[model samples]
Target chain A: MDIKNMQEAELKAAIKKVMQDNFGLSDIADDADFIKDLKIDSITRMELLLKLEDEFGVRVEDNDAQNMLSVDATAQLLKKIAG
Target chain B: MASKIVVTGLGWSTPFGCDLDQAFDALFNGKTATFRTQNINLDGLYCQVSAQIPRNEAIFPFEKWQKELPGNKASMFTIFGLEAAERALLDAKLIDQEGGYVDQNLKIGVVVGSGIGGLEDHFNTSQVILEKGANRVSAFYVPAALINLLPGHIAIRHKIKGPNQSQVAACSTGAIAIADGARMIVEGRCDIMVVGAGEASIGRLGIAGFCALRALASGYNDNPQQASRPFDKKRSGFVMGEGAGILILESEESAKRRGAKIYCEYLGAGLSNDAYHMTSPCADGAGAIAAISDALYWSKKTPNQVQYINAHATSTGLGDAAEMSAIKFIFGDCIEKNSFAVSSIKGAIGHMLGAAGSVEAVATILSLHKQKLLPTINLEEPDEFAYHNDKLINLVPNNGIEASLDCVMSTSFGFGGHNVALVFGRY
Candidate 1:
């Protein structure tokens, strides 16, 4: 699904589902840091970047991928990319 | 005082299916799970037949796990181990989503072994290093390839805090994991131990390595179903299988206090080394005999009391016959009287390598639980060479055998002449 056109709520839901299903995680907060809160390592971070790119139908630059560390940041980036 | 150990839960992922009843039924009915696979790059390889675990939506449901794991962050080995361990914990009634009765204060241990760990990740990482540079390699490559990390991941996933370790003894890894995990419980090191093995080495490197050793069954590539014929006159070699098996073991006192449904007692395990060849077993079967004898001795059970054996017959010409010689030497008249029933599940699922022992141990424990013996399919005519005493016992050939099983033995021998035998008794 092209997640680029998704609204803020839809984007957040999509991100939440990815975190839960991919990482065997639950109870994720919008402010939760992927590294600090989710305990996702660098490998998982790379995986998250690729998944978000595929979901939004937008290519994530390496620099921007590093900046998008939390759910809110990721959704914001997705909105900017979609626009 | 040492505590008594018992298996309260069992879980496994195999080619046939994960449901114990359905998987065991298929195995007993001579159903073959082997198939032709082009997944592994076998351009120059001789054997193309393998018992690869198909993406079963009902059992593993990777599509669900994939939403979160879109990239190659998680290895196939890790998935198998996690899935099996989760089911085992649920089966033991130790944990649920809301967190069941597993005490957070208690020290829980995990021993998930593997014969070959994360070969696909290793292969990809090496190519990256060669083309780009060492600095360009993925950070997860090292942790994913290390065998010990299997248990590390499990312990972290389950929040298990205690003696977390893994045993990598090639094919004997699964049996050794159970043996060592039980020892930890008996020695009062942990209240509960999650023990088993996982193998997902069906990659290009894995297939090439084994094929170079001439260790695979190549003739039946066109007929994948008949590729792994253990103890048969036409037996050649084992077909590579990928999966995992996990068993939840707890102290007898802990199990009783928690009112957990017990499966079988983890009597004891015997380990020995041939100190001979690296790949071939000794013709005399000296290591195997000692391992079985030591298992019986440690379990304090006589030869007459054990009525069934989950043989390590890996469908090899020498390996099959050597194991039978050892059995006959130990169980003697039991074989003649048909009192001892022997079977190998390798014929159905092929050789799972590291997961073979633990998976077959599950099969053995299921036999004890259901009071039945599973069949060793594809054994049309027993190889005359496999018989040492000139006596043939009920091999449970090609069909399931319904019999009362009180105690059972499961054996696993690896490439390094590593021999491990485990005995389980009715709880």
Candidate 2:
């Protein structure tokens, strides 16, 4: 739960696990765009946001959710939230 | 002259597996797929048995379609529908080996239906709203639960541009889907139509609801294989099963032009409503008789010419007898002389709800093609109605029989007394 204290590799792994388990995506690159590369449409994007909220126990605002589109961006947002 | 309709391909995702030959062989061998329900808690439910597709079966080619369409948004019925539709199109040779359309300009449409379209998904979403909150519900719930989305997804995947529709006649949905597809071609709406039904309602609520109606077999929970004994003396009620069946129906000229392998000709389809009861058939079987008679009349064939019948005998006390009464009324001398065989594949695969008629349609078409009769398993002792004047009707009990089958009819009746009879003949 301590995203601020978590290592970069651990945060990235957590994000990847959620994407793989929920979206059936595996080996997603950290910089791969969710919409462009993963083809995560609007519905799937909303689902990913809810899943992340449930996983991290944080309230993701609309603007924050938009920025948390990739593994790297999501990790950055989670660290900022934990702070 | 009306356009001649023909079935060029058939596919099904059945409890016996998806391969057409393998599933048909299992049915012919009288193999039962009903088993004790493994996924749901049966402590409070009256029925404990269901026939579900094996968990390991790769029902959806996830990797193949994920690029074009995300698999996470689809419901179980859509998943089965897509798999069956893909197999059917491939079988029709309309799709090349790489899953691309062979003739991209062909006018194709889709009509796929389901009895309880995504009840499992709706149930899950309801729980999510109750436990987590309404805001937690997934945005994909609506599309996933709509019945029309089955055909919608099919059309999107195949790029079919003609009329796209879905029928929701409960148990008769499958037969009516095929019938409507043929009508579309006959009316020059489309040259080809993908027609069929799918169902996946074996969830907790599905079982409890059917149990409340006492419409499911409960006595044979310990012996699941014998639970669905259609026309048998010990039959209690129907067993719930989940799967999908699809067929490629094309205009005769279109099929010949494409040089496709024709399975059978769609002779006629008769639709009628009992207007009798909510969940029960009329004791006189008038509605069923009308449907069968209409089908025969339109096909220009007499009862004597129909060598086999795939009945909608769901193993209920009143349903089986009602069907027999109707058959006697329509096929009068044929039943007494044992000239035609009647069998219900529900004995082997249980009742597939909306998918039953189309699955049985596939079986009937195959029977005409192979000149073989499928068997009704678990019919250890025939019910009294299966006989008249000490001569028993050929129920094709326990084992498959070889026969010269040219014309065959498949009948389906739903809870609302909707009846549809489809007649097919060898091409």
- In candidate 2, stretches whose alpha carbon ends up further than 4 angstroms from where it belongs are B58-71
DockQ of 2: 0.49
Q: What digit string (tens of lDDT, one per residue) describes model 2 on residues B1-427?
A: 3468899989888887778898899999889899998867768887899887867636334455454445348778877777788889999998865345546688788999999899988888999999999988887888888999999988777777788999999899999999999888988878899999999899898888899999999699899999999999999999999889999999999999999999999999988999999999998899999999899988989989998899999999999999999997778788777688899999888888998988889888988888889999999999988886677899998999899878999999999999999999989
User: Which lDDT tens digits does candidate 2 get at residues A1-83?
Assistant: 55767899998999888878777889999999988898878888888888888888887889888887788998988888877
Scored against the true structure, residue A47 in model 2 reaches a CA lDDT of 86
What's chain A's TM-score in each predicted model? 0.87, 0.92
Residue pairs whose backbone atoms clash in candidate 1: A22-B68, A22-B69
What is the C-alpha lDDT profile of model 1 across B1-427, one tens digit per residue? 3567899999888887677678878887788888887556788789998888887686566774455344455678877777778778888887874223355887689988899888889888889889966755655667777888778777766678889888999999999999999888888888889999999988789888998988889799888999998889888888899888999989998889889999999899989999999999998799999999999999999999999999999998878877888888898878767688889999888898999999999999999999989898888888885464787667889889789988999999999999999999998
lDDT of 1 at B151: 83
- Give the RMSD in angstroms, all C-alphas superposed, for model 2: 1.9
Proportion of native contacts kept per candidate: 0.19, 0.44
